[model samples]
Target: MAGGGVAGHGASAGETKLPPLTPGPYRRRLGFVALVATFGGLLFGYDTSVINGAGGFMARPDQLDLSPLGLGVAASALVYAAVIGAFTGGRISDAWGRKRTIAVLAVMFIIGVAVVSIAPSLAVVVVGRVVLGLAVGAAAVVVPVFLAELAPYEIRGSLAGRNEMMIVTGQLVAIIMNAIIGNVWGDQYPWVWRIMFALAAIPAILLLLGVSRMPESPRWLADKGRDDEALEILESMRPPGRAKPELDDIIHTREIEKQRVSEDIGKIFHNKNLVRIILVGCGIGFFQQTTGINSILYYGSDVLEEAGFGTGGALIANIAPAAISVITALIALQMMDRVSRRKTFLVGYALVAFSHVLIGTADVVLPDGGAAKPYVLLILIVFFVGSMQLFLNIATWVTLSEIFPQKIRAFGMGLAVAVLWMTNGFLTLFFPTIIAAIGISGSFFAFAALNVIAFFFFLKNVPETKGHTLEELEEHVTDGSIFHSIGRK
Candidate 1:
């Protein structure tokens, strides 16, 4: 069973009692909220991964007419734009409310997709990609927090982690669509790519429609001093016995948050503990990209083609990793609430590093002309992608959503995720070049080395977040106790 210290700061034993588990009807409502909010994640995954299959076609002379550098620019445009979007998304959500911000992003997704689908030149496509990037980046920061705030602490991990699941699901859907379209209409060239880009609009429309009727985050409402409104929302979402006490905890945290609000953004830098926490958040985001997951997702077909598969074969084989990603993400949702976040991070990095080593070794040892090389490499890549989905990706997003104090949560998450997107952008920009410069062996070995460092970073720095209410976690963050050890009680 999950275990943690009592909620609230300086509460007596009686006041520290946990609330009852939310009843069934309320649970279903929360589930629906999660489902609606995570569409942003679905759009995020699709826009980014669609390029993976469309890229080769777009580089042809008849399409965008991209040179190698232009191809890199086209591929990395959304990611770099996401850097700005993530940086601003948090602060925007803090001021505008989570639901409103997401609604706006859904609109941006539609516009961006249309622009990309109908672009007449490389410049227009980049412009469209940048617009989509902004939506993708903002969605990454806001959606997880929205889910986290709506959920009871007992189920917050699985609930917030659903965004990550949807992300991989989006990627899986993109890869499958790309395969069917590319194989059947391989002669259609740029049109096939345009069609792939356009399908993202359906989900964006669904997101806008669904979120229109959803409740504003009670925690966000409480933070804005609309306590009665917050209470009403909470009552509808929580069991009768649990609502008031949970509201009290949120009110207490907001009370603390107000004291720091006067300092504005200054507190984030002036407070030593706040700075430490922000740095930790940024580190987690940075290291997640360094694991080379996006590099594979963005360029898997290229990698497989290099390994000897034909273009069609490579597209088909790419689906295996994406399918495993969806499967492992489902398994991860079950594990999120049950396992310690720190344990998962450590195990995930270790396995990822090990997988990289095996892939590197296989590339070196396999005979150059042998039929076994591509199959062995494919299997190892599948294992690596599975390990990432089952462990790191869900835990990373969930922790980012929950780790900061209310006063700095949005800003802190934005800054951290911005670092993540920036790192991802750099990798996306250079990975094809990196693969060209160094064979698959060198690339995998380098990632393996980086994962070793990521493992130790989590061991020393990341605290266990399982079993703690956001309010309880906030107290630990503010006081600096959360950083003193990885497995704090």
Candidate 2:
């Protein structure tokens, strides 16, 4: 294998350290590919956030005239469908290969968006959302793994993290577009929400066209025993004079894996190391949602309206968190290589947990219907969202993509994300009722306490995956030595 970077001169004489890998060669090509692939994420973002603004209009008397239960069912339709997509997409990618499966998903995205745009009834819209959910679920599972396999060890976090960045960027676009459409069309036009859903198809078409020309994952090729083709793909993307050794390393590792176990999803539970990895992945996914971040993204307007902003005021104010998410996701991309994953996650949990408490306290102490109350609540919501974007969102996705071994990578990731989408679905389905029963103060306080528990779970369980190749990281993961370690091999 190609040698990594040399240790710093300041290191103690007795310490053994392999140098870090520099991220220089193929920078332009890799950037282009990452951009193309993350269009799936962009679609994921837009499709999900479009509901944030459009859901209210869809429920108006002139439209669907949905009851709260109806609204909850309609809002959660895509998420429930996504639970199935995450699992099915994982198996599809494993059998059909990553590139082909993503292309198929792009088609699904276009069809799903089109159906929702022109639906004459809520049932039709629900069906359309189910289709869109499949694409969103698949993209969530595949794009991160695709990027992780392609990216060099040194720059993997930033590259894989691009999918998440685009997800937020897509959401920001949806919020801005919803604002514009609502202002231009007003109540006179019944079809304004349709326009919001239709706009997503433009990017879906672009993803379908672009992904057709991109390369397949080299690791996928190597695992399938197509070493020569995998080496050719690696040579194009890797540093000069490095592809052969990397290819040799991949082939060698696969040979060892073949000797140990069959490539089966059931095998995941049978092995201790693999079980631990799956557990950690599931834990991160669960905690990320339980913090109630999606309660804001999926229903931020609802929260704002409950806090006392009118519908129009709430819609405009909703953009603040989306803007903050984009800004903070970019900041996270820059800081990813520089910071340890555990430290970033710990700091993020502390901020989110604190913000939740403050939000609850203000809601209780401040008088309702006062002018100061809504603005104050909005400010705290922004703080909580900003903290989540900076730490948990991108970090969680990137870590999940890296932690599993290549043999069960797709299946294992599928199981973890299935749990994530299912958890998200449950909360989205009931958030309105939860708020009606408990109010904003009680809900956020509950989330604050959950985040405190999340902090300890991460401290004791999560592994550091920064600064190592996917292949190198697998060795530590398989041997059960990576747990609770700092960024050490």
Candidate 3:
């Protein structure tokens, strides 16, 4: 209401207006907040991907003594637990405050790491993993939302997108640590995997300490009718002149939302527009996972082994794709504010689908045990990881964080990311068996087909969210006008 006209596509007359992007004196504070909150992302990455290297050692007869399926179950235990975490995390954040919820998750992370690192048996390890999974799942739902609600609209995409960048960064760190620990000490100590698992606690401790000093989400405060407190926090994040205007915008939007929809979660089903948007959010999560990125992150060492690398070689080679993910994720941060979310989704899915087909074809054409086969597949896998990180991963999380209106932001994000984690857990659980049964070529072929479907889904259903404020987007979303802007210049 107090700012300039909208500058990007999909804006029509009488839409919710946005203030200019003046971060003011407190921009440094905002940056620090983003950095601290993304520890959640890093832990998410480390906890999930560390197992890629550790799993092999854990499966040895002297260690956890796991069969292939047992290994899958063990690896996916945290993921399955995350489904419940994601489902419950949103509601918890809504009621408990985002910062407090994140702090609780940090404690959970520490407890989980401790449990897994010292476990004497697979059952105990799984119990620990389930604990970690709950933390990861909750972080997945809350961190991006916290960032989005706190960030200025102009840079919200990049700020919120930082979580994914951290996620990939955590993955890269885990891969490197796994390689070093596994190759250097694995021969003498069968339980070196515990070291890898324990390292996650450092970051978890840091996150807990950092978040304890951080402010609650201003948007959350305003929703709970604490305008003075919300405004104070917002002023620290926004320019002097812009903070009040933005608070006014948030309050006005919340009032409109309250008048239209009851606070009850079930009321969401009664509103057709909310239902459609929730489905779209879930679809975005579905497509992101269907690309099979996690399969590689979670089990790249095994994939490389399947491609022909020895154990040590596979462990070292696993770093390549993860390194590429970090590099591309940095590029994605630059693009987030400038690019159209819809276009980003479409390009990501197309490239991912193509990469899958190439990997599948290469696997078929390259003779078994040939020297070139593994290298060729590694290059293709790097390409696939790069595509997904640059386009899909950042876009998917940012969109989910920003799309839902204030009243239901937590619920919407929870349900959507629950779908995401559920899909990821499913793949992580059975990927070993799937790869054994069908081989990389067949599994990738299946992923390619799914990505193709994903590409079309984005084209038809997803709307551009490039230059709109959350409040602005809310008005269009509730009235079902957001989709009308799809394919519009």
TM-score against truth, every candidate: 0.97, 0.95, 0.97
lDDT on C-alpha atoms for all candidate structures: 0.90, 0.87, 0.91
Clashing pairs in 2: 5-19, 6-19
lDDT of 3 at 318: 96
lDDT of 3 by residue, 335-414 (tens): 99999898899889999999999999999999999999999999999999999999999999999998898888889999
Instruction: By lDDT, rank the candidates, best first.
Output: 3, 1, 2
lDDT tens digits, residue span 319-409, model 1: 9999999999999999999998999999999999999999999999997657999999999999999999999999999999999877788
Candidate 1 CA-lDDT value: 0.90
Could you report the Cα RMSD, in angstroms, for every candidate shown? 2.0, 3.7, 2.8
Error of 2 at 139 (Å): 0.5
Scored by lDDT, the top model is 3
Error of 1 at 225 (Å): 0.8
